[model samples]
Target: MTNSPVASPAQTAHSTGSICEFQPVIDELRRALNSTLKGKSEAVELVIACLLARGHLLLEDLPGLGKTTLAKALAMSVGGRFARVQCTPDLLPTDVTGFSIFNQKTREFEFIEGPVFSEVLLADEINRATPRTQSSLFEAMAERQVTIDKMTHRLTPSFFVIATQNPVDSHGAYPLPEAQLDRFAMKLTFGYPDRASELEMLAENIGAADRDRSPLPAILTPNSLQHLQDHVAGVHIQESVLRYLVDLGTATRHHRDVTLGLSPRGLLTWQRVAQARAHLRGRDFVTPDDIQDVAAPVLQVRLSGDFESPQTIIETVLNDVEVPVCS
Candidate 1:
């Protein structure tokens, strides 16, 4: 994956004082999603934060968990072009990144864009695809560009992928390698809804032929979202907080239960996610709590350990690390 010249988000944000101006837009986007994805406030907020952070997501859960609905609602709320790719064992790399087609009359090869070209792409049952097919997303996810036949095609600036996998069925699934896993900023699971929410869903469905078929209002355009991402880059981080973050990363590396530790890329993404979370809460600077709040989702995707689950390991790291004093 080759990187092309684009305006640096950090530089653009620094040119302005801070990202406080975009708070209203962020809040509105959150509310729009919240209204549709009921009873999953935390999941919705994290999904929004992941977008603002300019990182991909991995959703691991059972079927009928509304993962697809969440992805659709997000795309609708942002007013971005949405595409879905149903991963299968026979899916080819060319099918995902696109291939050049021969034009008979013109005697020229034309490029056909794949689903990945869209602003929002949902890779459903990603693990069901073969490893060869799965590797197709690495470049697109990391550099936002895909090289086909030595020609590189750039994806939209706001391109985001939400890949989902069924946790229960691993028989025919290919486990995502560490490299592929590292590309995702966070991995989350949306569990079953609470009794009250389920009851509401049932009651509403009983009266109507189709339940909750209302369309989600588009609150932000692609350009507006990119601007918000740039603004999020301006959120502040104190020196003490930086050191504290480093300490947590280093601790993950040396933890007894872990086979693999958080990579530098993971650490950087973790910081960006924390900043985004702070921005969502209407703050310009990140706090230790902000980092803590996002640790489980961020670290769970990257950390591999033998002693306990990733979430438990992350929580232990949080408890052991001293929170930096912020003025």
Candidate 2:
């Protein structure tokens, strides 16, 4: 591993930290994806933020809502290798992590990498796969490595999995187990586009003669992305905000609606995402507001309940609990 130090002192200032140098890169990515994504700037930003934080995303929405498109756009924007896996009921664990194949010529078992080896992997209709097949990703998402035949193979540095599932219908779908759901850093819903945005999309399609004509261009290379990740890790997070994040995670465990709360890993993920969001906004340090802004998406799926809306439950809990003041 090569260590290249990037200085960010402006980020060390008090209250108002300096903006990250990668802000321009983030802007270019947003512009590149604007035409293809139409009208969801917030959703696009959240996805990019997750990627910068080195976290996985879980998109739960109705079909044809551009879940897969967003994943592809992110992958393209980073110029990374993209792979799509159509998970099914009969899909096996070996199919995802790849099985050892015997090479007759070499007379030795060779491991052939699967789609999971790519930088960006889109697991479309993930719920369609059985629990066994779905669990296959647990190791890859958590450890960034796949174990087969007692041997482990490390995945690419920018390995990310964007999983999409249809929430409207559960028929022929196996709900992801709790442990698997915990691995996702954030869960997002891409609702139907508003009338104006929908109209804009129609007009663009009509003029281009094809929907894919103006696909988003690559704005950053994989190396640059890894650099951004390094920058995010260096972003300064205040002790007050850190305490608040810990308090928030502890509060979730005691919430009435939640049977289980965000784990320590989930809390760390939340902290990292908050820092990433600040970096995207050209800031070098995190704030309470940043924590609040990212708390919903970071903890929504990790904290579960039998409430009407899991997202609503999280929001309510966050709103009701008082954030501890740092002395």
Candidate 3:
């Protein structure tokens, strides 16, 4: 969970302007997400940072909390090809990775791709699927490719999976294995909307002629999103801040409440997310504040232990850890 070493903000700006130029895309995404997702600006911003960092996300919450809507809106806002697969026990691996069919005209087999071929995939009710079917996404998520009959098919450049699961019930659901959970960059919960936001949702539904009609639109292209990812990678992280990140990760490992701490991959993801957060704020270099802002979301799922609520546990851990001051 430690942060990596990066250049200072001044040094990064002096070296290049790529980070500065990518701000508009982040701004547009922020605005679009804010419009559709009222009263959840922090969650929306974290989701955008995950995308800009080329990381997958897991939205864990109860049913009908706008999880699917948010995923669809994010895919559309990035102008990426979006597909949704309702995960069920009967779903097969081939249903997601596609299968080869005999072509009479060509005298050979042709592979008909599946929903996984899309740029952004929404795996709704992911826990409802059998472990066999759930394991099917492992290859695509970790390697960005699907292997079928010894043939490997690479995914789109901006391939991202936003998976959703209902946390309240596990009666007929198969919990994601720890290994699979680790593949996700971050996990977030969309709690119930406040009174005012709930009222707005009711009002909006009252006037809508059809349920299919939604106001969200494509705001940014895939190419631009890829560029933004690159820009985030180039953002500066000072040595002191990097050490602070390292200290936090180390603390998690030694914390009495934590049975498991973040891995090196988790640490790298934490750093990347922090950099992306800084870029979203129109900063070329990352600050400790950026690390602190992103730490809870990026590391929450990575920490393991007995706690009343994982989110609350992470918040408590963050509050207990003393943030190192930088000169």
Best by TM-score: 1
Estimate, for each residue in 183-242, the C-alpha lDDT of model 1 and write its tens digit.
Answer: 999999889888888888787678576444787777777877787788788789999999
Every model's TM-score: 0.92, 0.89, 0.89
Q: Give the root-mean-square deviation of each candidate in angstroms.
A: 6.2, 5.2, 6.1
lDDT of 2 by residue, 205-303 (tens): 784664556655667777767766877888898777787788788888888888888899899999889988988777788877788888888887787
Q: Tell me the whole-model lDDT of each prediction, alpha carbons only.
A: 0.85, 0.80, 0.81
Runs in model 3 with CA error above 4 Å? 1-18, 211-215, 311-316, 319-322
User: Best candidate per lDDT, number?
Assistant: 1
What's the TM for model 3? 0.89
Where does candidate 3 clash, by residue pair?
A: none
Ranking by lDDT: 1, 3, 2
Which portions of model 2 show Cα errors greater than 4 Å?
A: 1-20, 207-215, 324-327
- Indicate whether candidate 1 or candidate 2 has the larger lDDT: 1
* lDDT (C-alpha) at residue 244 in model 1: 97
